[model samples]
Target: MSLAPSGFLNLGAQNLEYRMIGPVPEHAPTIVMLHEGLGSAALWGDFPDRLQAATGAGVFVYSRAGYGASTAVKLPRPLDYMHVEALEVLPKLLEWIDFRRGLLVGHSDGASIAAIYAGGVQDHRVLGLALIAPHFIVEDVSVASIAAIKTAYETTDLRSKLARWHKDIDTAFYGWNGAWLDPKFRNWDISEYLTYIRVPVAILQGVNDEYGTIRQVEIAREECYCPVDVMEIANAGHSPHREAPETTLDAISEFANAVLRDEGFRAA
Candidate 1:
């Protein structure tokens, strides 16, 4: 319920700010929850703990650079942050935290990262993956929502509220929003990589999601070679886990429990 004192994780060339929740249990593999673009350790809210309580697996949640309290990402982020998170940052994070194997619950940008990592990385540490309202392709809804968010932040209290959770709200917002809106970002595609993922993956998308449509999840389901499950939560938006944590957690728990069964791990 409370955040512990902030700690510094040495990311080779630089230090990244990170925090922890619990060692949870080993019933299923660990569930590493990746936050949205605007999300941080604190922004993950109470969902991780609730999920751990339900599934009895350790939960790892942290902020990516330029979000939450992590170090600033100095370079101009290529349109595919999912690739960067998958190839560069996540591997280092696993090594930094010594996370050997687990399930991943990623939302929004985090979901894209989870997908990329599950598919591209040669490491088989991931047993399963659950993506909440994930986006593999850019759509009009995504651009519209982002533009609306931009307008609101410039005119409303959204920026101040976000600042309470992020040290540099402006930087985080711009870094994420600006890149996604760029013309070159439209060509971003990770479907080629998705075909390589062999683990069980559950894709959860809000039917009314403002950022993505069913087409995205449909594409993922059709292309992914892994065991793919789809759950379309009705009447929700981009932050499916935040807006409806219980349903999202239940779907994630079921997928992880199934994986545990496959591996003969005791979930009961």
Candidate 2:
């Protein structure tokens, strides 16, 4: 499916950069994509397009403030930044985009943000959740990996690579990195939110994920009262959507279609 030109949304003090894939048919669902930490709309590449094609849903990909072409944010972001995003920003953003109801497809930090929003807000617009490599609780491996990434940013070409996606590289990187590396952040967990999620959840995690373990999925299964579908991809780590795009896409696409086909289910 062809796409319209990329556009920007002005939300008071901030500008959000976004791209729409396929057409936003009034009768069809819209899949809003929340990118990973240190990732932007562009980093998602053609995944959104493939998803749109596979599920026949409109796809919207956007970069949060301080990433990509969006406005830059202050340093030392609050430890509850993700909470702020899910509770405050996401609702406003969806309203801004005129999102009536659809699936939220989030990766990594984006996934956590999606879960938080679904649990916190009682809005029925959120039909289902497609969380890719999500983190509900902070893990030791997460901290260790983030620390290694910090070293890479300081010594390797990772910063240069990230420059291709972020307009304010430092703001984007440090905002996420600093928040996660903070000692107090170790206690940061959104497991309680999972208990409130009533929508069907599609979780895809890489078996060899370096940043998080299968424990993340385990937490979701244990806490969520709704149906939880999981895909543990082999030979993929941290980012199954990037490392194993086909497998990941197929799983989410199937789930979305199944939910849409069911007449008795409601999105909450």
For each candidate, the alpha-carbon lDDT, in order, equals: 0.79, 0.89
Q: Give TM per candidate.
A: 0.92, 0.95
Lowest summed lDDT across 10 adjacent residues in model 2 is found at: 259-268
Per-residue accuracy of model 2 over 122-199 as CA lDDT, tens digit each:
579888999999999999999999999999999999999999999889999999999999999999999999999999
- Whole-model alpha-carbon lDDT for candidate 2: 0.89
Off by more than 4 A, model 1 = 1-6, 24-28
Highest lDDT: give the candidate number.
2
Looking at model 1, report the run of 10 residues with the lowest lDDT sum.
20-29
Per-candidate Cα RMSD to the true structure, in Å, reads: 3.0, 3.0
- Candidate 2, which segments miss by more than 4 Å at Cα? 1-4, 25-27, 263-268
Q: Candidate 1 — which pairs collide?
A: none
Best by TM-score: 2
lDDT per residue (tens digit) for residues 1-268 in model 1: 2223357777776566665555532323567888888888888878887877776667778888887777777546667677878889888877766675678888888988888887888578788888888878888888888989999999999999899888778889998998888988877777777888888889888878888888898888789877788988876777778777778878888788788667665543
